[model samples]
Target: MTKFFNSAMAALLISSTSIFAQVENDTEKPNSNPPISIETMAGSRGVMYQLIINKKFQSIPLGFFSVTNAAATWEKEMTPDIMTQAHLTYTLFKGLDISSGMQYTPVYGFRSVAGLIYSYVSPQMLIIVNPKVDLADDLAAESLALIEYRPKINDKLNFYSRLQGMYGFIPKSGIHNRSYIMLRAGLGYKEFAFGAASNIDWYGPIKHNENNFGVFVSALLF
Candidate 1:
């Protein structure tokens, strides 16, 4: 299952890049928004990388989006560990969508998921809230939320910051599942951004906690 999961992720990423290239090479432009973005951080405790894709079809009514998140600790610790999650969403309304995807965590392994997402975007801020359920033996409910703010400090530089968190638990047995919170604050120059980042994670019924703090760099990859 692990091998299959890894392979699936590689294929998904590769296909996304291929589609991006094809779109650029062809005269048919889909949307003005960048199709992909990437972020990486190296903290005192570990290193983290994340990729997000918001690809919209010109012919389709709405858009489809995907998110991939991962992190690794310097000491190879499992607490502040590596994880990945991806979701595909179809827009239902202006700021609401139905989404489903898969996620892999150290504690939960890999699980199939289905959910809903609502997003709000403006000139200086972006917000997203997602609620989902795990289609597993335990039957867990999960939620993730994110907020990003970028205000113009000047024409060439903009202030950047983001807050994101996730939590999940079983409804029947009331057993705790997993949770994490992440924060990033930096300065962006057009497609490039750099600054401080932090991650806090909690796992399982015992609610063990882990912390990581460090610097980060991000870019918009078209």
Candidate 2:
């Protein structure tokens, strides 16, 4: 899996480089400020920090894109875990993108995967659907979804909430690999937000579960 993941990452990078070179002469200004979102959630369970990026290689085709989403967590009773997913995408149609990326977890180590992502994005609401399969041995499959809504309450504040979930399994044996659901709600002012948060995680085929509930503060940096 490690070897395959490295190869896939290299291939994607190389392909993207070539694509950018071909369009280097295009007469579009480069992006001045790439959008980046960062958040930190701490509770009775532990601390988790998340980073998300959606960037473009150029502006011509309007579909060339890159994404990096990652999270790291430290729990009181468990070993720290860091997971990352990155992929290059092209808009296949309205709100849909073909994705290929690397996924890392303590259980599976690293796996190269390919998948599709559908997104609905607006000022007040966001929805995403992502499903991918391992390109290496074991062929683990994973799916995830996230929904968020932040309606404007005034010029300086907004009501914020989000629900996110993910599940993974082995295709051949039909065994569950892992799953988790997380929820958050709060109020946002400028670049900071504070709210209540909860996380429920299940591990392995037996579905051993852990629960954490507490308050959280988060920040967004440009």
Candidate 3:
């Protein structure tokens, strides 16, 4: 099942790229919009297939073990081009969940990540702090802090918001500072979720280099 899903995701990405190329060729000049560029911009789309198997101990108030595998692809336009990461997450917890995972990418090598997530303040909010250690040369370790808030709006709908900040030891090539701000807003209905997010990256003294925003729609099959 995992193999099949991975193959399907690869095919989808190829098709999306082909379509983008055709559109670029058909148009003499591309629009100079935020997302649309005169030159072809690198982008990728893939299905994240995940499988989880877990067992909970009856004696403990909260004790569980689970295994999860996921695959994702990422691409950059002019600099730091194509890459893919696939990994499995092993989780263990008593009262609070502690997860450790490794992401392997052809270009970036393996990145080890450990995180602790806990919920408080009415159980509607979660705080996550993840420190990542990158094995690839020239890249340094980074820390990501995320605060997620989910509130039940009604029986049929809910709202979710996430704020994320990142700081890296070795700054990225093009960008000066490694700090960035991200905001996400989404609505969930049953198994369907739709969201849009914007990322503002700070670079140089002026703090203006590149900003990205995108929208996504997702559905859960099971």
lDDT of 3 at 127: 48
Question: lDDT by residue for model 2 over 45-95, one digit each (tens)?
Answer: 677666666555565533333333333355345577566777877678755
- Per-model lDDT: 0.68, 0.64, 0.40
Model 2 ranges off by over 4 Å:
1-34, 59-77
Clashes (N, CA, C under 3 Å) per candidate: 0, 0, 0
Best by TM-score: 1
**Worst lDDT 10-window in candidate 1:** 17-26
Clashing pairs in 1: none
Candidate 3 stretches with Cα past 4 Å from truth are 1-123, 135-139, 171-179, 202-208, 219-222
Per-residue alpha-carbon lDDT of candidate 3 for residues 78-99, written as tens digits (9 for 90 to 100): 4331222222323343213454
Q: What lDDT would candidate 2 get against the real structure? A: 0.64
Query: Could you tell me the lDDT of residue 221 within candidate 1?
Result: 67
Q: Report model 3's TM-score to 2 decimal places.
A: 0.46
Report how far off residue 204 is in candidate 1 (Å).
1.4
Between prediction 1 and prediction 3, the one with superior TM-score is 1
